[model samples]
Target: MKKAEDAQRLLRTLSTEMPEGWKKDYAGVRNEYRQAMEDAARQAALEINQTDPEVIEQFKKLRDDLFSSLSNHQARWPVLLLSEQRSVEYRQSVQAFEAKHSEFVRFMRQST
Candidate 1:
């Protein structure tokens, strides 16, 4: 859990960097981040389910919102999209969503 949070932060930092080495992998990073968030959300739900089902149910909505937002922004960047402000914002939003999701999950763990 703590490890995931740390890894997420590192990934977020990476997302903020220029897409030099990853010229064609910017979208891949976003997609992979989305996938990782979904997995984390699922784990969080499972953890919460042990105590209160409804409490964990909220994570699913957050997860859905994250994916929907990411999907809408996918490949919608300017021409020659080599990672710009738009990508940065989208990545940041995804990071924020994950951070909140992780916080929620951690809180649940503590309470449980």
Candidate 2:
């Protein structure tokens, strides 16, 4: 989704010297995601296809994992910005971790 790409850009930007008030903007965006997710869940509940117990169980499992990983994902961003130098090595390491975490998210999305 275009919004997902936009989120990645803003996130990377936040790691590289964010603008004033960006933290509040980031939190708001996060809340928006929660709201959207809730809306999707409501839609799922209404759909006739949502009757399967196994499917519902899988969705619950993924939701738990997603929230747990979100904590680590948020922590990693500030860790990437730890040094004032912002060396290539640090960037590369954080990028690699980000890639792996992104893949984890993709897996979670598919699971749900």
Candidate 3:
């Protein structure tokens, strides 16, 4: 999660500092964010596989919600360079992802 946050922060900074060219200039940052998310998802899947069946069942909804939010957030990334409005939408998506992520974390803790 921290990795995701860091990547996102870097992206936010890039967008703010170089809104016109961030996507073309900092493609590496975008890749980093993508890689971090993919890594996190892979780790979560591994953990879910190791968790007890009943516990996993209880978290299915939460896990799905988090992924859904994440997908929405990712979908906004490409359009962020299009307009200020897209950037605003991207930020809102980030907030939604954060909320879903926190909810998922809380449920995971309870599952343990």
lDDT of each: 0.56, 0.54, 0.67
Which is better, 1 or 3, measured by TM-score? Answer: 3
* Most accurate candidate by TM-score: 3
- Tell me model 1's lDDT, rounded to 2 decimals: 0.56
TM-score of 2: 0.46
Off by over 4 Å in 2: 1-9, 71-112
Measured with C-alpha atoms, the lDDT of residue 88 in candidate 1 is 62
Clashing pairs in 2: none
Per-residue lDDT over 1-112 for candidate 1, one digit per residue giving the tens place of the 0 to 100 score: 4544555565555556754664445445555555665666667666555666666565556556555655655445422563555556665756666656556655656544
TM-score per candidate: 0.52, 0.46, 0.59
Cα misplacement distance, residue 37 of candidate 2 (Å): 2.3
Candidate 3 off by > 4 Å:
25-28, 48-51, 58-60, 80-90, 105-112
Q: What would the per-residue lDDT of candidate 2 be over residues 52-89, giving only the tens digit for each residue?
A: 78766666565455545555555654443444576776
How should the candidates be ordered by TM-score, best one leading?
3, 1, 2
CA RMSD per model (angstroms): 4.4, 5.4, 3.7
Question: Against the hidden true structure, what lDDT does model 2 obtain?
Answer: 0.54
